[model samples]
Target chain A: MTARLRVVSGLLILAATVPFASWWEAGLVRHVLGHVPLLVAAGALLAPRGGRPVGQPTAIAAVLVAAFCIAFWMIPRWLDAAVNSPAVDAAKMASLVLLAGVPVGWAWPRLAPLARGFVLAQLASMFGILGAVWLAAPVRLCNNYLVDEQTVLGRIALAVAVAMVVAGLVAALAGPGITRARPAA
Target chain B: MRSGGLALVAAVVAAGAGLLWWGTEGLSVFTAETARREAVALAPRVLPDITLQDEAGATITLDALRGKVVLADFIYTRCPTICTVQGSDFEQARAAIRAAGLGDDIALVSISFDPEHDGPEELAFYASRFGGADDIWHFARAPSRADTGALLRAAEVIVLPDGIGGFIHNSAIHVIDPQGRLVRILDDDAWREALVLAQALADDTAAAAPVAGGAGT
Candidate 1:
């Protein structure tokens, strides 16, 4: 990675951990939104541009780890802990960036196009399902957030799901060559 | 190579499941709020002996009210929505208890978590809006913030500021046994169920007391 990109990613991490992190503590919508920039920055920093294909075992492991990391944090108890406790909040940030983002980034270019598509489709569906659940839930899931704030987050999650599907379709249409692993130099 | 990959996948799944089970408090609840309610029900706890000021500006401790089943709820007088509903519900429940002649067995208490703003005057005014506090029903506040926090924590009540001078909090009618242990948390609207449970507990206390008195004699 270029020094410029490294510096940019560092700044993004800083903004996410400092201002966005503090701001998100107030509401669920801000909490979900704050995570996006941090995830993007962390993923981008570690994603390989072009490399020999990673072994199928390693790729699958990385994807599973990423999925588990995301799902674990989405649980309401953990989410509440992240908001209420500074130690848990710091652990949340670290695990998201290191455990989820880093592995997903490393595995993305190595996976076959079909595998990549499958991952994206699964993510979109998960978000959609979670959105519907949050929207329709009778009880507030998180103690720190009010019901209205949860509803807003549900809408945003649905929107994000749609956007992910669109982005995935566009990527697929753009052809396999774009993400195909290159022979290692 | 395929077998090794499958093993790795299996291990990851197992680990994830274990973590989730732990996080959800033995897979009993997905939300912390539910976990808290379930935890209290599973292991009824004796509340801290926090001092509170009644609407009449008299100091009282939770221990002082022992030997009568207490139906308690956390409320702030200034709440715009659910607290009012709870207040009315408490009034109806109080009337129901009195009508049934279970008034001596069951007691209702509304503890103001927002003690900073809900002083004795505010509590009294709020109580007056709902037929006023009597021997059966009382409106009280923990005069100190620390005491309020301790009471809330003991009751597993979660309260957060709504950023508009009001609070967003979980609402429930907590049922405490004659022994002062918080045994059940019923939905705010389930005051009927709360009454039933409190009456049963009060009866048990009554039954046990005579036995203890006989043994002492």
Candidate 2:
């Protein structure tokens, strides 16, 4: 790719991330934080050149999960009043998964072999944390709080699931691209 | 090389899930469903002009209900609690008055606070459910929000709902004479006062009109 092409590609990658950034601000911080690695990994795929850090297969698998998340997240916004409406308990849960997944698809090129193992580990750990939280605490739902099904704990568990899935998808998709882009020198 | 990255991901996932769950388990909801049954005091003054609504969607001014005993209550059907309770109370009172052979001379009107959604059909349903919903019970619905607001203010009775959906306000039945003037208010009357007021108002109308004195006289 030419210098100009690289720049354009970088821009396309960045533009795709704008919605994620905006959503993060509008009550999606949990999803964003949970899956930050996948987003960074995808950015590395089309923009910067980051060599594989570890188990690339794990991260790559995470990328596919991320893509699925992005597709699902768009569903709610699409169904509403062309912009905003129909905010239900179900929509909130769906958003958590999407926020975590999109970054993996977008940044696959950056995450090499280590992505798969990393994602699996993250998901495993998350489950433990969520079960503990549920067992230890009492839950409540209110109108203002937009977390998963209106529970703080549910939101956390969702965020963890999304992050792991996104990471795996990214590493799986970005490996080949990263290998091909190796310097001619 | 990616060992640190994997560890970071795991740590975050674990911590976030754990903390959020713990927080949720501690949450409790607060609910309120209380409503005031007693009437609020108000000073006497010339009744405000209100273009009351009739059952047929026609505009009937307050003056129209005059020259007879007018019994009015503020109600809304969506009101899952208070309106139903008050309405049922009003209906029982109406039944009692009728059983006493005093239905002809008195008029019962129920004006809805939620004018936008509660129309003729909704009002009719509420009336019909408890019976005595025909000509004698005028289920009035305001044409607009402004009209409802004015009516609430004019009656010196305000009903507001709490966040939990229960209404909070005074429940005083009004006694309006045929002159379109408020003759008196039955404080916290519910149904009992309603029956007495309806009967007394009927007698007032009879005494005022010499033509109806044939049977009662």
Candidate 3:
């Protein structure tokens, strides 16, 4: 599709959807998009035109994390909470739809296994550090990290952000290697 | 690739970005900080499996709390906001215990998350606020941050303060059986009714063992 069309579709979606969560009133699109849009921008910048295609783009990590997020993290949580919380269950659908729309960098060659492993390990490390620090800190300190005892739910949004950043950086870095021979018209 | 397809993908991404921005702003509106739970769904979050320093500076393991129904709440005297609400709620719970006359059987403990600010003296003041029996009503502050955090997390009641005197936290009172196992969460948004429920539970428990026959059977 033409760049113009890509831009327009992206804008139209912005107009059509007002993101909402399940449990409570109102929408949360603005709060999250500040960080999410970077992924889209990264993907669009890394779109390959010709030649061997760069194997990795920063957006690759983002898409991978987002995809994994939908599968492992988000689904179980939604299902678990859906049983007891209408608000959360409702928000789950809205979150899925919105998350589904995030763009891609369209890397052609694909990442080396090392890069993929790095991304995964990085997230685990982040979580580990957060958890460790959280354990050592005061209970009041955790109020910033979470609102309640259910660490799984309270930490989801942050986990998503970290995953995106890690993946987005990978996608961005991949641009140089794959784009050497080809250029999008 | 089809221009339309690429465009479709971009559209999706952009839309996601928009939604994310909206969700963040809207989500925090009534966050726990601003809005409190109307009716608490009290889950029995077990207390940290550690020995704690009592008001007397004695090592009182939760095991030591056995043989008595224990009522536990977390607080820091320095707090001016929700701590006050929580403290008041706790005091009310204690009063309710007294009113119900389960004073001897039930033990009310106000553990402080801020051990530094809530040492024995501060807890004494906090206990003083109620002006009741000091024997059953005891306030203990952890000696270290890790211990305090563990206890608070285990209790599922975290203490967060707004830069100023205001505090933010979850107020779910726990009732433990004589064995120290957390049995029930008190849902007295207003301590007035909570004590009644606590008393009823204690009475139920007391009567349950007696009603069931023993060795002779």
Candidate 4:
């Protein structure tokens, strides 16, 4: 699909998810799983393309910021605050869409193969660790979510993490020749 | 799309599909029945010790009720809807406790989130109307708006002011064990279940105290 189509699709998904995000159960599902990917897709579509690639250092930093942003949102306190406070909720949206998603989309492809693999490994580990914690926790992690919902989320997260790890491994084995970042135009 | 982009799209699709299933049908590995039971079992969180005023202008601290299984509910005197049902359910639980001769071991507290309209006199009148016996049940109001909000926040109670004059709040009986930790919160009143759980908690506390005393010696 063209960049415009990808952006439109992302926006549409976002618009649809917003209504359900007001609910207790559905809200969490959308916030954690829905908005993150949708924003990333839209951001990727809109990223600076075909220009001189960002420096390896800048790209690495952006990837770190994006990963940190994702991890920050997964904390129980942040989840609780997002549900209760409107300002925090707004911040979650803005930070995910504008700061994390846009930068990661713009920077990830520009980084060297090794750097890209490192970022992927970091993301996979983060998701895997977080998923295990959420799943094994005996008590409810977030005040806003039920134990069952948390478990479901954890399972999904772990599954996605596994998929990401497998994909990363495949790319790594395929070697740098095929996966190398194109030189700056 | 390139192979890499295709893989990315697939990942997104998978995540989205999983989320959609959960958001819509709540289909999870754990059955709904199993989840509910697990939720109830994982209780006894240390409740915050917030003090408010009872109907007689006397200060009531949650810490004071540490030795008693306190069945608490949130309500405002001005509520026209579900609070009435909550009041009835609480009354049933109170009666059940009294009948079981655990009245002294268990206390019922109705906390008013709307301090503006549910002061001492208002709570007193509301309590009496709901069959709130003087010794068994006490109705109280939060000392201030900020204090009330804080108390509610600590309890994880969501209270939203309805566009009307009243508030929409979670209507449930919070069962605080003898240790002051809220052991269970039942929306159904579940008089028998509440009594059984409260008795178990009381028994657990009784069993642990002697061990502690022996250790101290």
lDDT of 1 at A153: 84
Question: Which scores greater on lDDT, model 2 or model 4?
Answer: 4
lDDT of 2 by residue, A33-152 (tens): 433333443343444334444354345444544533433332222212111233532343334324443345334545654554655676556554643453343421111223242244
Candidate with the larger DockQ of 3 and 4: 3
Which residue runs of candidate 4 sit more than 4 Å off their true CA positions?
Answer: A1-46, A49-91, A94-185, B1-44, B215-217
Instruction: Give the candidates in order of TM-score, highest first.
Output: 1, 4, 3, 2
DockQ of model 1 vs. true complex:
0.60
Off by over 4 Å in 1: A3-21, A36-54, A176-185, B25-28, B211-217
* TM-score of every model versus the real structure: 0.88, 0.40, 0.50, 0.56
Worst 10 residues of 3 chain B by lDDT: B30-39
DockQ winner: 1
| TM-score preference between candidates 1 and 3, better one | 1
Candidate that would win on lDDT: 1
> Which 10 successive residues of model 1 chain B have the least lDDT summed?
B149-158
Sort order, lDDT high to low:
1, 4, 2, 3
lDDT of 3 by residue, B140-204 (tens): 87788888778765554545554366555656566776656676665435465546555666677
